[model samples]
Target chain A: MVAAHALTVDDMREVRAAAQGGRFFALFDPNALIAAIARSGDRAAFAELFDHFAPRVKGLLMRGGASAELAEEIAQETLLAVWRKAALFDPTRASASTWIATIARNLRIDIARRETRSRLSQVYEILDEEPPEQPDATLSGAERDARVRAAMTQLSADQYRVVELAFLEGFSHQDVASRLAIPLGTVKSRLRLALSHLRGRLEDLR
Target chain B: MSAVHRPSDETLAAFVAGQLDEGLALVVACHVEADPASRQRLRDLQAVQGALLDAADPVAMASGPRDVRAAGQGSRSPASAPSAPEAGMPQVLRPYGLGPWRSIGIKVAMRRVVVPDAEARVFMLRAGPGIALPHHKHSGLEWATILSGAYEHEYGRYAAGDFDEADSSHVHTPRVDPVEGCTCIVAMTGNVLFQGWLGRLLQPLVRL
Candidate 1:
């Protein structure tokens, strides 16, 4: 039985390896995969998405200071959420990657907050039990995304660093300051400038 | 819509990253509901985050359950219509199960929201026209979003859709406009420390 299980694991690994190689040829479009899952509970489409996003989500959570085990758990949960919320995905509003990233971030936050609440229940009383749900925003088109991407390249090195630390690593302002060995005020100003520049470049979309 | 006071970029970014505490996020959610411009900003920020996700280096996931067939079977669809808020209540605050409003001062009433994981005390405060709240400073973060009417503090006038964020460093005494009473949802992290003789005298009587 143990030998059979090992053989099954090896077969799965081979399948995944083949899928990874296929990425170079077909360049899987997450948007189309999401649409497939939404229209019909397409297991193949979901497998493709799971293969591509699960690991990236895990990496992001790990970078945000979660333990490896916790990160993996959240990553799986994030994909589960994507599957559950697929019908709500309006491709025109957001790309699949962005939507999935949000699910991962929110799950991590929920877990962290729950732990904190349990630890500090005696000192701090939280009255509301429900988590805050993300608002559905209408995202711009692909053209706007390209423009915003172009605008990002125009940010100063310092500004980009702040944005990277804050957004990608989920660092707080103080965390960014201490990580970069800069004053807290400096971190704040740099981040503010970066956001303002990006907003200005994308204002025409509005 | 243009006049609606939006949260700062940092706060909004924090909201996008899911880093803001639940209480503060709720206030931002309320603002986003009333203001389309802020919602647009949120989308823009989220798109940027999406691009970041795309650029991230992929890590190899460990082999696990390969069954994707029953993945979402037990999950409810997200297409269902959001339940309508109680009459005269904002949709964002409907989920909290607010308590009965009790008189906190003359022509002023407040109701506490039951948020289980929040370090902050979330509540709704309503003041009659021309009523003035005693001057006070917060021990930590204090976030208030105006629901209706307008109030003027030392900082400036805050009207409907305005989100006022304050910390321990700031102090203000707000007065409602005489023409219209003001109602606000507030999430406070720490106790309020009243300033001056009158404020100190009233502080003991004030439960919030």
Candidate 2:
């Protein structure tokens, strides 16, 4: 499987020290791979994650309006950030993909502005420290992703449109209203209703 | 279910999408950092964002994993937290530039705090113990979070880590708590207009 592709002696020092070192039959679980990277700075696992996610992130960034070159650069930066911040990944709080998406979002903002993003996380990155992790009881990344996808499909077309504009494409409520030729109240209500429905479906995690 | 004033769900959604202006995001970040419930909400919503990303059509990258890995080498630098200038100030605001505190009214003082990329003017408002400010109404959005001590308006008392939002529709005089006084970070969009005779008297001389 994916684990088999990572057994090569990429980093001689980390061969047996990593979780992926001898487990040829091990599944390519992103969370487990991330833990292995954090546990031993596993390059192979990082490579696997990058291979699995970079193109996806690049595509997503392009969809969000980044140029191909910028999207490619941002995707690479996102993964590098992933490698750097693997230790901060909390599976219970957010899945690897979700965390990666957050990283990508931060990078896209920074890259778009072409400046040092004053986002708190950037400062934390400079400080090389994060606030103490708070304990959270929630679904794992994959399960949460599945649930969110299921919930999104249940939204009405109008509600989904609002979500796509307000969330996926990062439109403001006023902008979403203008884009759809709908009233501001309708945009806000649709967003509220959609988020509530998705939030209700996600309540089992609590 | 009960908590101090927090940003609305729509606002949080915008924050999650990286769509909020920097000043508003900072205020919300303070609230989210202080409140675990909001933090969880942010994560839950981000997962949905991740799902949306997953559905995007894949594009081929010009560079491969090896190229990314190679480029990432030697990019890691040691990160150190800046020495905090004031106690009880939220960590999110510790990195930006801050100006000296300036006295404006009898007990109220204001200081400029720069938030990079912020459209709204950000500042720190510190008041002496048990002082009542003149009643004023806002023109645009105003977000204030207590960093130290407490303040009470018509709405309620807000202590450390408490967030208060006032729009043009919100008008009230905020009185600092007697014992602790108050220090709050405020991000305001428009001017604050005084409510009474003070409106015509101090409106020109006093600045918030």
- Every model's TM-score: 0.82, 0.80
State the lDDT of candidate 1 residue by residue for B1-208, as single tens digits.
3435678988888877766667777777777666667767776787777777766666667765356666655344332224566786666665466888877668887777666677676778888999877776667787888888889988899998888888888887888989899988887776443445323543565455
Candidate 2 C-alpha lDDT tens digits along A117-184: 55545542432233323435656656777888899999999998888778754567887898899999
The docking category that best describes candidate 2 is: acceptable
All-Cα superposition RMSD per candidate: 7.7, 5.7
How close is candidate 1 at the interface, in terms of C-alpha RMSD after superposing the true interface residues? 6.5
Displacement of the residue B120 alpha carbon in candidate 1, Å: 1.8
Model 2 chain A: lowest-lDDT 10 consecutive positions: A124-133
- Which candidate achieves the best DockQ against the true structure? 2
